[model samples]
Target: MAFDEGLLGQEAILSLFEAARWAASASNGQPWRFVWSQRDGSELHKRLVACLKPGNDVWAPKAPLLILTVTRTTRERDGAPHPWALYDLGLAMGNLTAQASSMGLLVHNMAGFFPEKAKELFSLPADHEPVTMVAVGRLGDPEGLPEKLRARELAERTRKPLSEIFLGQSP
Candidate 1:
């Protein structure tokens, strides 16, 4: 799932999962979970794709896969509270994004998806909360995006200097 393989095909989906399997978790609880959909005759894909905010809708249409990542409130191996479950999920997503990038596929993590609607739509277990949605696809020409989004398309192109992010001092 390289960055170029935007919205993964069948093979890339398998690879992404393989990469996610190695994500570090709190006490090895492995609370991170995913419900995936490919824009291949999946009824859920219709609603899921429609759920993206207007800005995302423009570029999301190019994605081949949509993933909903969830976190479990309880540990799988023990009954302890999964305090770092969300953080663990983040780590998994990070790995997924990097893997996708390495594979030449593009991965977009979107927060604007309808989380509440997703919960009811997927019928997720009571303890599992759908936290975020990710769009997997190959990077397309930015020209295809709406004018408004085009300007911000590469907004995150550069990371802020480390000095501004962390300095052992208050802002």
Candidate 2:
């Protein structure tokens, strides 16, 4: 869906992040971290926007909020390779988006970003890796989107069947 330039209240945003914090994680690692910026046009926001790729930057930058999703690549306790960190982060993001939906907000996740640049720009720890970004805001009229995007947003949404996605036989 397209998004309006609607701003979200601090309490509402906090609720979404808090919901993500409670998601189940491998070894209770809770390895997800978010570097978020609002549409107030701060320098930080501009810097974050530069991290997005061309096609994504076209629309994502207009959302009310942008979040750089990072995951700990190694276990925090002993620095061992945390193979499940990315999966754990996905769980957290699931919680966040669910909470946003419940509050009548929208979230759009994208992989089109330069993670290396994001790391360098933010001075994040080497163990923490950026993988995805999310745009959050209130739903808006499809007509508000750029022509190409409007068509894509209004197109019928489709997904692979569970039978096609899963490995084993159907239950």
* Segments in model 2 whose C-alpha atoms lie over 4 Å from true places: none
Cα lDDT for residue 82, candidate 1: 79
Residue-level lDDT for 48 in candidate 2? 93
lDDT of each: 0.77, 0.91
For model 1, what is the alpha-carbon lDDT of residue 12? 77
Mind giving the per-residue lDDT tens digits that candidate 1 earns over 1-171?
112333456887888888987898878777888888887767878877766767677666557888888889888776677788899998888888888888877777888788777778888888898888888877667765667777787566787887788867656
State the lDDT at 153 in candidate 2.
Answer: 92
Over 4 Å off, model 1: 1-7, 154-156, 169-171
53: Cα error in model 2, Å:
0.6
